[model samples]
Target: MDEQQRLAYWRANTALIRNLLIVWALVSLVFSILLVETLNKIQFFGVPFGFWMAQQGSILVFVVLIFIYAFQMDKLDQKYNNKK
Candidate 1:
């Protein structure tokens, strides 16, 4: 890739990473910690929603995000002719 192409790819990759990190932070910090109390008012599978989020929801979200990132990056790679 040319220098300009490399720079564009880098910027696109950075943007994707930044967006995913934001989602991760929202799930891990906001839902698991900050909103735990309010979420606990709801129940799922006999467990408090907040407790579930703290224990499992964030993990699930992270896994999902990983898949999403991989899928998106594949498209990005194709767009940039970097796919292998």
Candidate 2:
């Protein structure tokens, strides 16, 4: 690819990674810690929202999001001939 294309690809990849990281961080820190008090008042599936988020929900979401990101990035890599 040309310099411009290379720059664009890197920018896009960086943005995607950054956004995902922010989302993961929010789910981990905000819902899990920062808002735990308010979240404790809510319930989901017979468990406190904060408890579920800290122990299970966030981890599950992170796992699913990471796999989705990996799959999408693999396709992006293939499109850009970045994959062997």
Candidate 3:
């Protein structure tokens, strides 16, 4: 890849990472902590939503995010001719 392609690839990569991090923070911090009181008003299965988020929701989201990152990065790699 030339200089321009390299720069664009890195930019796209960083943007993907940034967006994923934002989602991670929103799920792990905002939903599980800041919005706990409001979320608790709702129920997930038999448990309170807030309690579920703190106990399991965040972990589930994290795992899903990992898969999403891997999937997206694979596409990104193909786009940049960087596939393994």
* Highest TM-score model number: 3
Tens digit of lDDT per residue, candidate 1, span 1-84?
Answer: 899999999999999999999999999999999999999999989999999999999999999999999999999999999955
Candidate 3 local lDDT, 1-84, one digit each (tens): 899999999999899999999999999889999999999999899999999999999999999999999999999999899855
- 1 or 2: which has the higher TM-score? 1
Reference-based lDDT, each prediction: 0.96, 0.88, 0.94
Better of 1 and 3 by TM-score: 3
TM-score of each: 0.92, 0.89, 0.95
Q: Cα deviation of 44 in candidate 3 (Å)?
A: 0.9
Best candidate according to lDDT:
1
Q: Which regions of candidate 1 deviate over 4 angstroms?
A: none
Residue pair clashes in candidate 3: none
lDDT of 2 by residue, 1-84 (tens): 788877877887888889889999999999999998899999999999999999998989899888978987887787677755
Q: Decide which is better by lDDT, 2 or 3.
A: 3
Candidate 2, backbone clash total: 0
Off by over 4 Å in 2: none
